[model samples]
Target: MGRTILLKMLLFFGIVFAFCTCGKRPVADLPTFHVDVKQRDSASCFFSGYSYVMLETNMECLLTDVDKIKVDSEKIAVLDRERILFYEHDTGRFIGKIDRLGKGHNEYLSIDDFIVRDSLVYVLSAMQHAILVYDVYGHPIKEIQLDAFYKHFDFWDEHRVFLSSDFGNDTYYNFVLFDLRTGTVLRRFDEFSQNESVFFNSFSSFSGRNNKELYVIHPFDYTIYTLTDTVFVPYCRFDFNTEETFDMGKSFAELSDQTRNKSVVKYLGNLIESDSVMYLTFDLFDSHGIGTYLYKRCGQQSYLIRINEDFISDFPYLSSPKGIHGNTLISVLSASTILDIEETYGLSFFRKKGLNKEDNHVIFFHKLE
Candidate 1:
């Protein structure tokens, strides 16, 4: 009996170990999730099941805007105006908050972005040129000073980070691989050659999925790249081949604001990935409106499903997904937007969820088909 019990315990631990390492593959070891740019407006698979996480709206956790969100297995961290709020991911229960939003050395004036790793949170303050680290429960750890111009960053590994700079100006290198512990840059890329005519993107999104996977898009270049432990490699390329794509023979000097707005498909980012599928959003010219697509990872073209929400589609209303959990694509929409849809289409989503228009936003977990 003792030998039989010992064998069973070893088997149980082996299963647990396999579950933990399943999603932790070094990125280069993983197969590529393929997508074609011309299929931007193609037919999509109908995603069937979803759930709403109504963020607990109390006096301490009233959210004005959800600028950014990071989710792990248990906790969800949201970056609001000046504070980073925490919530229970499965139940949407409000927990504590990190509100060191003052001028003191320990506090940050603003939160440009935030990254959550293990139980630690790294809040980036662009204006202050520093990153304040804290525990998940709002306790201060330490602050890491930054080199003044990194607009956005995501952890490439435990000791290294991938940093991005502003577009348009001929100032800093477009991207850098920096050593956080050694205070050194190991590599620099895309040094701007043009000095005069400027083109810039106001925001840069360094999309990270569970710290094991990191992806970024070039400001004007239509290629999306993935970062492994050592290098950034091309993951997918967009060739819209339409008149609206910016690089189709248009010179930088001849473009105006109106033309730039119409060419959004050219400057696409917000690239979110999961283990089985990849998702992103892009705008079409004029009345074409916004779009979301779920490109399956197995290299079959037919698996691409355009996540469309007409007034009566069974799928819940969705925008760009902020992150991914397991195989589900996670997105958040304001309760107000749902109230508007309710008001216009005579739907009862808000009423069913016990949500008021002014309540906190709702998070959607879309389990892909």
Candidate 2:
């Protein structure tokens, strides 16, 4: 009986020791890839743009200055100025528009940002500190008022929303979780660290969204983090060699004011992750160059995707790119760019049902191989 008790005590102690050791294990280092723009330009996978027809109505609305875009399985959404226009994904048919911009009750004075999730559209209004919910047909469902004003926001789930602002200071948190139903602050993470040089030109925060994870990159710091429950854990690191990477010691505002182009670093833009690869697009201001990178996880290899033709030449980089269903990137093209594509490459691939020069726009779809 004494030998049996001794054996059980030894087993219990061994289990406790193993659990303590496992809890103290350090985080593994994230993978880094060095992208050489000049070498990648020659060896790249090229993709061309094809035009899609837009169904016209008596509204006579033209999407001139589009700001943001979001995609789902069946529909594509574009935030054109103050309106959120929905289009059929298979065909670029104008399905509906959400343009309830007013100062009255349940009406928004200005729209800050929007997201389409689960057949519902959530529009954030900074002016009124409210979120207006709508259906796919542009019908009003409900509105939720937030206590604080946020410049940028995205819906995380049915009841939670992630919010951010450029005007954040030491007192203001960089990102926060707000309850959608009651407009109450649930949790806050990451402090705002931008100094005075952030006023000349501002860029949106770098964020990527998949079905299961939400990733965000710090502006001043080059660290990418993923949201896990209530905290953001570091996910990956971007290395641009010794000379090309941004100086983390100085603020971006300071770098912009002091240096012309010599000390300025490459700006990180939109990032999206797939099953086997990660897609990121950035630009170089000193040399006026834009590059899209794909990092494959199988062999841990990264490559720069150079669109050979002037597919998106009108914009500096892929502006407001959204990862649609089937792991594809989709964006809306202006009417002028559609004409340019038609002139350069013949219209055999395009279906010009009711598309005209100044009235209709094209939908650009890019599939990864």
Models 1 onward score TM values of 0.73, 0.75
**Candidate 1 residue-wise lDDT, 151-204, digit = tens:** 678787788887776443335566777777877778876565543234343246
Residue pairs of candidate 2 with colliding backbone atoms = 197-253
lDDT of each: 0.66, 0.61
Name the TM-score of candidate 2.
Answer: 0.75
Alpha-carbon shift of residue 180 in model 2 (angstroms): 1.1
Off by over 4 Å in 2: 1-28, 41-59, 136-139, 166-171, 193-206, 241-246, 258-266, 286-298, 307-326, 345-348, 351-355
Candidate 1 regions with alpha-carbon error over 4 angstroms: 1-48, 166-171, 194-213, 247-258, 270-278, 288-309, 343-350
